[model samples]
Target: MPDVEGHPTREEMDLRTVLNALADPLRYGVVSALLREAEGTARTCASFNLPVSKSTLTHHFRVLREAGLVRQVDRGNNRAATLRTEDLDACFPGLLDLLRANP
Candidate 1:
């Protein structure tokens, strides 16, 4: 969970990192889902219903978190995730829109 806890700050995010993290379709789906999800609500990872294995899902989540596209918080015994919508909008402007439209 150390890497999970090491999410990049908004100011630290770069276009390259974000795009690289999203290179996979699974990761892209993750962001797309978050974009439409309600704000201030963190969804559990299992709720995504990805067809990948557990480790694959972890890889996707780690990439999104490290890229600063998502914020994950530990809630009781589980982890919850939410999109960093404002941060991405400020950094890349309309990137989320593109993802939502394309995904």
Candidate 2:
């Protein structure tokens, strides 16, 4: 699949970067929510309802996107985010399963 602008390509995704991005509880929650969604589902940022302010939430998403854990695209006035499941699976097998299990 084509990557969202500014997102790392599947081959460029790195384990350390992903781990760092997921280290934050709020960021992990965002990813976990995406994991529970139907495969390929893209959710708008506002839908997450995270406790942080909009700017803070944007920072979280940027971190995830830069780490290659999510693909984010502009949807009109909002941004939509989808987990990079295929890329993550290819780069680090069982990682998502571990997250699901722990959560």
Candidate 3:
């Protein structure tokens, strides 16, 4: 499938991208929110419970998308973000499991 931005599909997303995307506390929070929601359920940009500027929020989402930690969909006025559940599982089978098991 085409990426959110209509870019060509990447053959594979990298581990570093996943890790770097999740490294930030805010981005982590965004990931957590997605995890709380159902699989493939797209969440609005305003759904994030963070105290950041609009530009900053956009930046965080971009990081998540580039890292392949999340998939974003353009919905006219706003964008929706969801976890890359299957891709992540295939790339790092127990990554999230370990995170949940530890944290």
Q: Top lDDT: which candidate number? A: 2
Candidate 1, residue 2: the lDDT equals 26
- Residues 2-85, candidate 1: write the lDDT tens digits: 243977877789899999989988888878777777876689888999998988888788888888888898888667889988
Instruction: Record all residue pairs in model 2 with backbone atoms less than 3 Å apart, i.e. clashing.
Output: none
Q: How accurate is candidate 2 locally (lDDT)?
A: 0.91
| lDDT, candidate 1, at 100 | 84
Per-residue lDDT of 4-41 in model 3, one digit per residue for the tens? 57322345577786788777888887887777777899
List candidate 3 segments past 4 Å from native. Answer: 1-10
On the 0 to 100 scale, the lDDT of residue 40 in model 2 is 91
Residue 40 accuracy (lDDT) in model 3: 91
Which residue runs of candidate 1 sit more than 4 Å off their true CA positions?
1-4
Error of 3 at 13 (Å): 1.1
TM-score per model over all chains: 0.88, 0.93, 0.84
Q: Give a tens-digit lDDT track for model 2, residues 1-103.
A: 3254779988788899999999999999999999999989999999989999999999999999999998998899999999989989999999999998887
Q: Which ten residues in a row have the lowest lDDT in candidate 2?
A: 1-10
